[model samples]
Target: MGFRDRWVDWGNGSGFYNLRVDDVSIQVFRNGFALIILPRYENIESSDLLSHVFRDLYKAISYLYNIGIVVDLDSIKQVNQEYAFNHGYLDDVLRGRPKKARVELDRDARGLFNKLDQKAKAWIDRSYGDLEIETNDLEYARRLLLMPEIIYNLDKKLAPILEELSNQIRLHLEVEERTLSTLEKLSRYIEELRDLQRRPSLFKRILNWFRRWFG
Candidate 1:
């Protein structure tokens, strides 16, 4: 089944509030506060999807920030129970599980900034000419890296990356079975080294004794 979605009311002339990234809905208010809600899905893996959602959210935030809007970090910083899936595979994950998932508040904002900086560097390649046209500012990228909403939104974007990383690992393991077998053979050879018989040559034995003593 697919994801079940919802959105808060967008009043008339309220300075554009609705932002949807895939199945997640980010409702922005005129006052800069925003709420991110996720759709409920059944029996679905969330690890990857969540990553992509958050990453794209960061992109969206970059878009918003460039327009000179102050991002409310406090409003969208934390992940609440409201964002979790309400039904389908997601519901099953919480069926016998706890009502809420543990969210970590401690984070490295500096690292996030570094990432934003990298993206901005790439963005310049595609926007260098446009950047010179006066509507260009990199401060938004800086704000996005520093804002809590960006981080919160980032969690959604990262889900897909995580899934892709997982799939890559799985593929590597599957395709490297022959390499694993070769390593196993090497391990066996090492294990047999201790059982190797001593040579009977007096010269070789004397050399071995010398090596053991000082070489």
Candidate 2:
């Protein structure tokens, strides 16, 4: 049986299904939501496997209404290395116990799941156009598979340029602030000099009094 069939069978019987593929684990609950635990791996095999799993899982879950999939990318890297090493497989890591897959929201959790399901379906519809593509379209599948590599390469090339631009902006802001501070100090000094000049000097006052007495 296919993975989805097996998962459905188990879920129907137990109200929950848990499966492990490579370094990742997938848990689906009766509420029609799933949690995907993705691990950090530098190897190409792991990356390819992750993408495949994501596509397949999305395909399998797309038929069901009111389902949401939450992907936890950060938590997997925080897993204890020693524990992971001991466990070897994801099923072993869970110790044969299925993790709780239910999400708790205030008062309207089912509504939230339904919203998520609708959004996911909308995205899929936009991407694949009514999901009418032939299942045996190898060329289409090949292009889809290349998407991850394309994104990775683009990100790798763009990161340094983005960092450089950010640094330049920060430096410009610092210079602009210093310039403003200097202008403020200069303005205060000019204002003080103008105030001193406006006051009548002692010599000028004496000269004016002499002129007045002579007249």
Candidate 3:
């Protein structure tokens, strides 16, 4: 289901939201803080979906920085496997006698678990490898999840910062343009003065002045 359809209110404008990107499920909980879950799944598209989700998360983080809300990476974990399922599937194997169907089901469950485990590890690496953040830290994870809402409330200050930067760049460019124009005019004037010094009329005027004085 869509995120809006699954949004559940917890109270005080805090609640649960399931944000889906393509086929991936990213669960977000809002309780004066945010909690994000990257679901574990066994599918061919799972890796790509996870990568896309990380990119989206980074975009959100960058937006926060642009708005003067710097996220503390120390408060975020690189890997969190608490949501990863346990080996309850092994219990099914012991429940039935040595039948062909039971063997197939057991094998399938094992394979599914392996795939999910591998995917979860890879997602953790890709998400938090360079950040150097520890995984499974409860407090850090809490701050990381609540980042979106924290930045949202600080949104009012963003426009002024952006406008100030834009104005500074514009002023610099205008000054550079004016400086170039002034240099071009100065160079042209110098060239004209040099040409006048080389002209026959100027020499003639000097000759005439000498003749008038010596005649």
Candidate 4:
């Protein structure tokens, strides 16, 4: 039977689900939402096996969702860029807005993985029979097998949510500034009208109209 160890914490409001199938380990992070991290799989040499692993991962995720788990797929993007490529691009991707910035970053992330896979395969092809091959190239091949840490559809699906939130924040701030300016202008106008009443001069009214029209 497959082994599973899952826990949900109340106080810290963060939880994780871990499932083990043979040598693979799948871990899920749950807080405001859910993000599942696919376990490391060995043998990246076969592209067919790698594709199968991705299919199996989606199947597992579907099962979890069918059972009522709200999972965030974007979490995978972080792992793919940060752990897999060992590149410094994760920070820019995660910290940036999900609409345009995140989309752009994830494209870069995918490119990185593709490049690594190509490099690993090329290395394998070149060193297939060579006895002088170094350990570094072999390690890269192993990494290719270790399921890319990033999830699919993360940026595309969530970009709208991110864009909405950002727009709301910006709209609220802008409205507030406009309201403040209007109120200040109204207050000053009331004071001028009060002065006009006290002075009772036609010239003051004409001056006020001129100021309103020009200023």
Candidate 5:
């Protein structure tokens, strides 16, 4: 069965949703991904630069996943490390798992966790991850993601240039655009997943109160 099939109240607007990217199951509020109106709502072509970016991003994030999140030191201007995932893939991993990702000389430091010997080669139990977007980043992601037309329009406008560049400069501009888009979409997707859970509207809150009081 699909992951959403396990949702408790998927039919209601107030239920939670479970999205399984892999072994990790991200639980979100009802309709959490409903706002993720991505542009070009079609399968990304293998030749598309964005496909490469997405695949690399996923691989980087998943490499040390069993150990925990690999925090990007340069991704945010603020350096505060936040909680992300957990590591319990071994009987002793829980005892020594790093609280968060370690930083590298520059960009993503997820590589730091690659050499951890604490993890067993075999599968084990784990429950150390949380589905969250910083409270401060919600609007940043929501607003940019809501404008799917902009991305589509830009892609259309650049069709000629992209075609020319593919033969000449070899997707330099396209690669930049694809890379940025990949990061933006991932951030927004995470924020969307945490939306209703963090910022329930007044009406929803009241409804929840009623459910509790009446039940």
Candidate 6:
């Protein structure tokens, strides 16, 4: 019902802000990017689930960004500075590796390490284990809420099928939430993501125009 954020240490000289709801996680990165994490479920059809989640996330971001959660130029500078310094200081990741297995950082990515100020770097890197470092720094949670990939952990299956009886009208789906007790409860438009492949319906296109003026 509400949204909140916390700092997450990404290691190797990077980290980001994290906000979550049940199984869905929203992340804002230091580099001005966002991601929404959703678990692949066995109950709700995936295409239907993606569409519903996309809309909900879009609305939530619009509402939240309009209210206050913002990342300005100054914040971007600070986060980058911190990440650059930390990455440079965390020499272990770049050193002591077999020549064949060394990390292959791109030119621009590797340059971040050269711009570091050792004195400003966090020696302890509290993000490794300390839980209390800026635990209340929600404002520093940074920006971003959507983009890129949807990583599905196949090993993290929702639930095993206990029964598969034929001719059954009802199916027990172990998906998004407990409230979705049956398959019928999923959204009526089950092909939201797939629908993008063709073209949007006339009603939907017109409906969007009306929303812009009315709401």
| Winning candidate number (TM-score) | 3
What number of clashing residue pairs does each candidate have, in the order they appear? 23, 0, 2, 4, 0, 0
Stretches of model 6 off by over 4 angstroms after superposition: 1-5, 59-215
Per-residue C-alpha lDDT of model 2 across residues 1-215, encoded as one tens digit per residue: 13455454544366556666556666666674566555543325524644754564454444222234444433322211100011123444445343322222223111211222211110111122222112122223344558799899999999999999999999999999999999999999999767756775954676688799995
Candidate 5 overall lDDT versus native? 0.43
**What is candidate 2's TM-score against the reference?**
0.31
The alpha-carbon deviation from the true structure for residue 48 of candidate 1, after best TM-score superposition, in angstroms, is 2.4
Ordering by lDDT: 3, 1, 4, 2, 5, 6
lDDT of 2 at 206: 61
Error of 5 at 194 (Å): 78
lDDT of 6 by residue, 1-215 (tens): 23334777778858877776555666767686766554433335423645765565555465447646653423322122222012334345546533222222222221121332222212223343321111111112121111112223332342233223321324333343456544444554556534643666865776688799896
State the C-alpha lDDT per candidate. 0.49, 0.47, 0.49, 0.49, 0.43, 0.41
Q: How far is candidate 4 from the true structure (C-alpha RMSD, Å)?
A: 21.1
* 1-215 per-residue lDDT for model 1 (tens digits): 01113334546644435666666676666564766665644334534655655666676566557655556654444433211222333444445554433322233222221322121121111122211111012343245335788888898999999999999999999879979999999999877653443434665676699899999
Q: List the residue pairs that clash in candidate 6.
A: none
Lowest lDDT sum, 10 consecutive residues, model 3, at 101-110
Better of 4 and 5 by lDDT: 4
* lDDT tens per residue, model 5, 1-215: 23457565736456765444433334444432211111221234424634644554464345435434343534412211122222234335446644433222222312112322222121222333432222122223233445587788888999989788776766677788899999999999888757755766854886788899996
Is 3 or 5 the stronger prediction by lDDT? 3
lDDT digits (tens) for residues 1-215 of candidate 3: 22467787778776777545444444455432334444444332423645755665676555445644456765654433432212344445544533212011121111211222222111122232121222233333344557788798677678788899999999999999999999999999999767867997986787788799996
Regions of model 5 farther than 4 Å from truth = 1-129, 137-139, 147-150, 167-215
> For model 4, how does the per-residue alpha-carbon lDDT over 127-201 read when each residue is reduced to its tens digit?
222212122233443544453442335666788999999999999999999999999999999998777777767
The per-residue C-alpha lDDT of model 5 at residue 135 equals: 15
Q: Please list all clashing residue pairs in model 5, or write none if there are none.
A: none
